[model samples]
Target: MSELASGVQVVRGEMQPWSDQATPHPALAALLTDVVPANRRTLILGPHAPQQIESVLAHSADVTILVRSVADAQQLGEDFGPCLQVIAGALDGLQGEPYDVIIATDGLDRVLGYDSSDLSWTERLGALAGLAAPDAVVVLALENEFSLLNLLDSRPADERHGDDEWRPLHDDPTRPVSVDQLKAALPWRAEVYADFGSRTFVRADVAAAARPGELPTRLATAALESVDVPLLSPAAEGVDSACRAGLLGSIPTGWVAIAGAGATRDVYTQTGEAVLTADQNLTGWDVTITGDATPAFDPAVVPTTVPSGVSVETVLFRLAAAEDVPAFRKLAADLGEWATTSRVILRWDDVIFDGESFAYGVSPWVTEEPVDKEDLLAAAWSRFQDRLIGQHRRHPWPPWMLGDDLVSAWLGMSGIEPPEQLQATSPDTAPAAAVQVARGKELAAALGVLLETRTDTVDVRTALAEAEEAKQELFELKGHVYGLERTLGFRNKAMKTRENRIRELRGQLQRLTTAHERIRGSRTYAVSRVIFHAAQVRKPKTVARKVARRIRKR
Candidate 1:
C-alpha cells in the first residue's frame, strides 16, 4: 500500500442537506435516477464532492468516491458510511476493479490536489478512463461554450461557477469545454445532452424533446434586479428557434456528455420533479398541457387569461365527482363539453363542493364580476400609465421606438381604427376601456403617418421626417421648460430670502434713527452744539487770513 493510503482519514460534515430539499435540482436528480443504473457499481470523481450524493446513494447501489484528500475521504466516509468506500490520493489508487459507471458533476479539468497528488487533468481522466468497464458509460458535466445566454447578460469571468457557466467570453482552460473538446477528452464517441445549470442530471433525450428555444436558460439578472429591464429582451426573442437549430451547443446553460451509452429507456426516470419546473416558459399562468384524462381535453376549454380588452377565455376547468377528493381531477368525463358551454367562468377554485364532496351543477346565473373586474383593472392601469407618463413627460419620452412598435402592433390587429388623436376619460370608462384608449393613441399616430405617406408621394416622406423632427424638438422643449420651472421655484425661494433681509435692514435703520433722536433731544447735545459754534466765531480773524489766501489763489 502507498504511504498516502496508509493515513486514509475520513471526511467529516453532513452531506445530507443537498438532496433533502423538497425540490432537488432537476438535472442532478435526473442524472442519478435515469443515467446511473440501480445495480451498477459507480465511481464519483471529485475534488470537492457533489451535493447530489444522496440522490446517487438513494438507489441503494454500490458507490465509491474517488478523492486525493484523506480529509475528504474521511469526511465523506463518516457521512455516507462504509458502503461508500473512499479511495485516497489518486484515481488509480483503487485496484483494477471495473466501475460500471464513472460520473463527475465537477468539470473534468477542475483542480484535484487532494493529498497533493501531482496528476495533470489529462492524467486523471486517463486513470478514470482505465477504471470504467468497456461498456460502462462515462457521464460528466461541462459548460456549453455557445449558449444563447452567453450573448445576453454576461457575468464577470472569474466569478462564474456552475450556474453562471454561460459567462466568460474568452476561452478559460479551467472552465467547461466545448462539445468537441468534451468528446475528444473521452475514450469513445460521445453523446451530448444540453443541460440547464450545466449539471449532467437530465436525460439529453428529454431536453431535446422540448421545443427549440424552449430549453431552459436563466437570465444573469435576478427578478428584483430586472425591474427596469423586462425578462424578455431583444436577445431573448426567438431564442427557442435558435436553440433548436443547434440543440447541442447553442441553447443549454451547460451540457452533459455520455461517452459509452446513448439515451435509452433508463434515461427518462426523472419525469417529474419540482426543479424541472424552474425552467417553465415565461407565461402569466402555468401549465398549457392539452389532453383530457379519460379521452382528450378540448383545446377550447383551456382558460387563456388574456388582457382585459381582448375576447378570449381559455382558462382550464376540472369537474369533481359524486365523491369528494382532496386533489384536483380532470373534468374530461361527462362535464367536459358542459364546462365549455360558458354558463359561468368555470375554474378549479370556482368548482365549489359541499363538505361531503357532492357534485353541484354549474351555476344557473352568472355574476357581473368579470365586467366589474375589468373596470377596476382599467382604472388601476390608467393610474399606473398616468404615473409613468407624468414621470416621462418631464424627462424625454421613452424612445419613440416604444411608440413606433405600439403603433405597428395595434394597427395590425383587426377592427381598430382610431381618430387623429385619443383623449382618455378615466372617470366613466370601463377597466377594459383603458387598453382601448392606449390603442386609440397608438393607432391614431400610426394612421397619421400612413395618411401622410399616401396623400403625396413626393413630399410625404419629407413632411413625415420633419414631423418626427418637430416631435423630438417638442420633447427637448418640454425637458427645457421643466428645468426652467425648477429654476423658477428656486428664484421664488431666493426672493423670499431677500424680502426677509430687507425687512431686517429696515428694522436696524429705524433703531439707529430712534437712538440719534434720543441723543439730539437730550440737554447734552444742545450744550455741545452751542460751544462748538462759539469756537468757530472766535476763529473768524483766522478766517479773514484764510479768505485773503483764497482770493490770492483765485
Candidate 2:
C-alpha cells in the first residue's frame, strides 16, 4: 500500500507479514516498487524477515517499523532499529492518527487470538482504514487455502458425537485466518489477489469506489471491466455482493408526488416544469402519477421537454405520508430534480373562496403585521426595568439606562416621583439596583442607544459592603466548625486506643476463665485437693485424741 503526503506529494509504501519469509509476495513487491513515490515515509508491521525490511529501508531512509515488542525490534537489527516502534498492545493504540498506507499481511488475523465471532477482526480493519489519510491505501495479504480449508473443516460430521466424546480441534498455527472471512468482515471494497499465491489485497480507493447512485459512468465501466471472476465484482451485473447477499437493496429511482389542499400547488407545478425543462434524459416513459390532487392536474401543463442524452424512468404516485402540507413540502425538497420536473398541483378551494391573500408566495409572511416603531420601543423599554418614579415610573427600564438626564425624563413620563431619600440611599442600594437595571438595558440596546441611564453607584456600594460583612460572618462560622472537627479528631483517636485496650483485656480474662474450668475438671486437681484436706486432719490429731477419751467416758 502507498500514498502521497501533502507538502512534497511523495508516495510511501508499507507491507505487513505474519511468517518469517525472506521474500515478500510478488504482488506486494510489485505494488511497493510501482505505487510508492520517492522521498515519502513508509511503515511495515508484523514479524517480517529482517532482510525484506532492509531492502525497502535501503530505498527510503524514512521507513518505520511497527512490531509487537522491543525484543522483536532488537532482533530485526540496525536497518530497522532506529525506525522500529513497539505497538504496545492491540491495534486500538494506533488509532487517532493518519498513516500514509497500512499493509496488513497475516497480522490482522494473527494479532487477535482465534475468536469464533468476527467482530474484533471487523472493528480492527475498520480502525486501520480510519487511520489512513483520505487518499492513503490499505493492503491486506490473506491466505485463501486457510479460509477454504477451515470452511471445509467446520462442516458437521456424518454422525454427531456423543456428549462424552465431543471434542474441539486446535487451530493450526501456520494459518491464522482465511481471505474470505477477512473480506466478509471489512466494510470497504475488497478483491482476492489471485496472482500473488494465496494473498488477497484491498486498496482504500477500490474499497470506497462509489456510493449508491453516485458512480460515474466511466468508473462504473472500469469496475465492470476489472471484474474477471464471479462473487469478486458482483457489481458487474449491477449488483454488489451486499445486494446479492440481501445485505442492501438496489438504488431507488423514479418519482413520488405528495399534494394536499394546503400544499403549494403553484410551487409544485413550477418546480416540476423546471425539472422537465432542465433534464433531457427523462422523455417518454409513463411518469407514475399519484396524489389526490396530482392526478387532477392537467398533464399538458406539466413540461414534457428535457435536455438531450439524459435517461430516466418516471413513476409518479402520491404517498399517503405526504398528505399534510409540511410532509408534501419535505417530500418535494427530498425529491430534488424529480420535484422540479413533475408538476403535482394542489388546490386550496376554501381559502380561494374566502378571498384570503397570502403576503408571500410561501407560508409565513414577514409583513403580516403592521410595524409600530413607538410601541416597539415602549415594549422593549418596559422589559429592562420598571422605573419607580416620574413619567417613566414603573416603566420598563434597561440595565444600562441612557444617562441620568434620560432617567429623570423617563421618570417624569412614567409619573414616578424620585425618592426623597434618593441621595441618602444612593451609596448603599441605588448603585446595585441601577447596575442590575443598566445590565439588562445594555443587553437590550445591543449597540443601539436606547433606554435612560441612572447613577445609583453610591447606594449600590453601601449594599455591597453590607453583603461583604455578612459573608465574612459566615466564613467565621465555617472556621469555627473546622476547629471543632480538629478537636474531635484528637478525641476520637484517644477513644479508639482506649477501646482497643479494653477489648484486649476482655479477651485475656475470657481465656483465663476457660483455663480455670479445665483445671477444675482434671483428675490431678481432685487428688491434690484431697491430700491437702488430709494434712489438715492430721494437724487436728491432738483434738481427736481428746474427743476419743470423751467418747470412752460416755
- Residues 424-468 of candidate 1 have per-residue lDDT tens digits of 477665443335455334433332332121222222333555689
User: What is the C-alpha lDDT profile of model 2 across 435-539, one tens digit per residue?
Assistant: 433533433343122111222222233355568989998999999999999999999999999999999999999999999999999999999998888677755
* C-alpha lDDT of residue 232 in model 1: 21
Off-target runs (Cα >4 Å) in candidate 1 are: 1-24, 47-51, 68-72, 88-95, 114-121, 148-155, 159-176, 198-241, 244-248, 262-554
lDDT of each: 0.44, 0.35
Give lDDT: candidate 2, residue 342. 18
Best by lDDT: 1
